[model samples]
Target: MTGRKLFKSAKFQEVNTAVKKDGAAIFVDKEGQENLIIDNPYAIRYIHSYAEDTPFFLGLADGKLRGTKCGACNYVFATPRGNCQFCGETTKWVDLPLRGKVHTWTTCHFGGEAFLKETPYNLAMIEFEGANSVLLARLKDCKEEEIYVGMPVEARFSPQPQFSITDIWFVPAGAGPGQRSKK
Candidate 1:
């Protein structure tokens, strides 16, 4: 209600009058005309099968990072893969080092629903010493200007795991939570 206006998309459905009301929304178009939008919210429990990627999520819960290694060609992946792209061979699970250097990074001005509260966050592609590829993860405890190619970083795990990628994030090598780089 300040100088800015807030607008959000909501689920629209035919509402039953017999039930307790949810609410409604007002949408303002560029023309400054207001339109009524019906809001009918419902909770859902969604299930997904990770299949071959199960090990990666499980490892995150255990405060570890899992990558895949090709036995036939010695190809290593920072991102877990079921098969090797180079040799077309089945890959085995391997542990990735906790510390890595930033290969590249970007500041996210926008993000998905799970990350909305963390808008304007930093994401980086981390390069491990032995891994052939990079892993994309959220970079915390530093501002966009402080992040650069080859910036040293270390992994931190969520104490309570949700079995999601958000369970693992990175920070400047020695930076703890709520600590920002001096740069």
Candidate 2:
């Protein structure tokens, strides 16, 4: 059976809870089964909250790109650090343009156990406008043959109704912005 189908089985979501936290509702499964945890610091830092600056997810919801700029040294950070990496000063929030270019990318044939049974997906590192750092997000709306280094792209959000929050995804802008394909 496919990983998606296996995950969709009744056994997987049996003890799931739709709990709200910090204005965002999330699905909490208590069945003691292995599942994807996207927000874990060891996995990926989804928000800038680890440092107190605005997170990229929030910026995507508001239709903007947000970053942290050092108030003391005027240094801009892409991961939105709380303090300047260079000067160790408090970082200020800054809004960035939605436009960006693909810096690097890879197609994943195998992910966690859940995705192991499914087809491959693409992940990309995108460098946004006015920022010296790159952001990592899932890439959508284009085939593998069409993706290239330095390709222009934009950020898009998919609403997760169960959680009442939006998940950010990226796609090629020239092909058509905001287009997503089913996994």
Candidate 3:
């Protein structure tokens, strides 16, 4: 599919509500009220450097896990480093399978920005197979007690306009693959 088609698919459009005049996108929960701004100009300009890892980010949006690997020393870097840590070599992006296990997680009760109204949600670190790396993201569709270290997890993408592809989140395994549970 074309880039626009891939982005306009039902799944991609699910988390978004409307695009604003400034190119910022708004996300709304089931109640139809705006929950967050995905692309506020002030925030975007400051965070745009994070977009340099677009390939890695886009892979997440496409439901795949990816990392950067050093060409010189074959070192794998997680979280899309601009350069390899081991050999100071320029890194190349590589795809990884979307299967992993939870390393750790926490429930945030307060102190996030207003955009994230869903406080007390579970945030987690997922360690994918065959890579000495972990992705910090949200754990969806599962309760706090249910999330345990070593529990299998998978990647899920949240489509927010003008945001990096790393906007991906994780949900516990057996929560029904690729399905969004009702909140």
Best by TM-score: 1
Query: What value of lDDT does candidate 2 attain over all alpha carbons?
Result: 0.64
Q: Model 1, range 111-174, lDDT digits (tens) per residue?
A: 8987787788888999999999999998888888899998999998888889889889899997
lDDT, candidate 2, 1-183, per-residue tens? 122212223332232321111222223346645444222223555642433543655555566667788888787776677788888898888876677888999888888985687458888888876787777778877778889999998877665422212366678886665456675
User: Model 3, 79: alpha-carbon shift in Å?
Assistant: 1.1
Q: What is the lDDT of residue 37 in candidate 3?
A: 43
Summarize candidate 3's per-residue lDDT along 1-183 as a digit string, tens digits: 111211222332553434333344444445555444454445433525555577776666666677887889876665678788777888888886676888888877774586367766788887876666777877878888888989898777665523553367777766675587442
**Candidate with the larger TM-score of 2 and 3:** 3
- Sort by TM-score, best first: 1, 3, 2
RMSD of 2: 12.8
The CA lDDT of each predicted structure is 0.82, 0.64, 0.66
Weakest ten-residue segment in model 2 by summed lDDT: 15-24
Give the CA lDDT, 0 to 100, for residue 94 in model 2: 86
Per-structure clash totals for the candidates: 0, 0, 0
| Clash pairs, model 1 backbone | none
> Which residues of candidate 2, in runs, are more than 4 Å off?
1-55, 114-119, 161-166
Off by over 4 Å in 3: 1-47, 159-162, 181-183
Error of 3 at 88 (Å): 0.8
Clashing pairs in 2: none
